[model samples]
Target: MISYEWRGHFENPEVNALHAEGFDHAPLADDWWGQVTRHSLGWVTARRDDTLIGFVNVAWDGAIHAFVLDTLVTTAERSRGVGRHLVATAVDAARAAGCEWLHVDFDDHLEPFYFDNCGFQPTNAGLIALGTSAPRHV
Candidate 1:
């Protein structure tokens, strides 16, 4: 059985491994504990038998707006509702904290998962690549 928790205690390596597996990248030892503690409104963790299987970070603008970042589930755990549960748990936590807006940005391929499955509506949004050349006026 998978158990979900908001702001749950986690060790960096387990989360790092899960993230690496989910995102299909080599694991980097990121300071997840410090990052979440310092910047997140909260985070949700999904565990099965005490092993970290999923995670999602909720970052807020210190008030009404919350952004969902780095939603991840182990590759072995995907397609089984673990990712959905993680995001759902994060959404509830944000709403309970009085956040009025929840935002998420994802690649084009993930639209169905974010929209059809998770109930996110389409919205006009903008992004600029950091450390890259700025856009030139026509």
Candidate 2:
């Protein structure tokens, strides 16, 4: 059985592994715990038994707007409504916290999941990639 938690306890390595698998990349030593606790409105975790199978970070503008980031589900757990549940949990938590708007950005392939499944409306947005390399100090 799968269980979900909001602001739940999680280890960096487990989340890192899940992310690597989901995003198809190598695991980096990301400080997920520290980052979320410090910068996010909250986060959701999906687990099967004791294994971390999914995660999503809810970041906010420190007031009325929240953004979804790093939504991930383990490859084996995909297409099982786990991702939708995670976003639903996030939506409820953000609403309870008094956030007026929740935003998410995703690739074209995720339009149906975000719009149809999660009920997010389409919106005009912009982005500017600052190059792959780390930014240099002025």
Candidate 3:
């Protein structure tokens, strides 16, 4: 069975490994741990027995909005419902935290999967990218 854990601790090695695997690109500054803890409420990981298969981070503005960020399942683990489970769990957490809505900015190429598999739909009014005048956040 697959197990999920909401972590109070940051797994730096796992974060670095995922980054090296091309699933992440954020620069890990020296204060990375502090920054992550300050901005994020928790991280969740999917494990099959002793191996870590996937992970995601959850961020909330505390009062109003919540965003799902940096969710990744290793390529080898794709299509096995791990992604779905992770997303469902995130949705539950968002609802429990009193968020009015949950949002994630995803790859345009994966629209079909997000819609068909995860039940997300494109809104009439889409997203905006204010390039480089602000720090490029993913």
Comparing 1 and 2 on TM-score, the stronger one: 2
Model 3 CA deviation exceeding 4 Å by range:
8-10, 22-33, 124-138
Better of 1 and 2 by lDDT: 2
Residue-by-residue lDDT tens digits, candidate 1, 1-23: 98999999999998899788877
**Number of the candidate with higher lDDT, 1 or 3:** 1
Residue-wise C-alpha lDDT for candidate 2, range 1-138, written one tens digit per residue: 999999989999999998899888999999999999999999999999999988999999999999999999998999999999999999999999999999999989999999999999998898766787756556
**Model 1 lDDT, full chain set:** 0.91
Write the residue-wise lDDT of candidate 3 on 1-138 in tens digits: 888777634456665665555455554533435656788656677887766677777788876677777777877788898877877777777777778877777878767666777766667646556876756767
Specify the highest-lDDT model's number: 2
Residue clash pairs of candidate 1:
none
lDDT of 1 at 126: 90
Error of 3 at 30 (Å): 7.4
RMSD of each: 1.9, 2.7, 4.3
Once superposed on the true structure, which residue ranges of model 2 sit more than 4 Å away at CA? 132-138
Whose TM-score is higher: candidate 1's or candidate 3's? 1
Give the Å shift of residue 29 in candidate 2.
Answer: 0.7
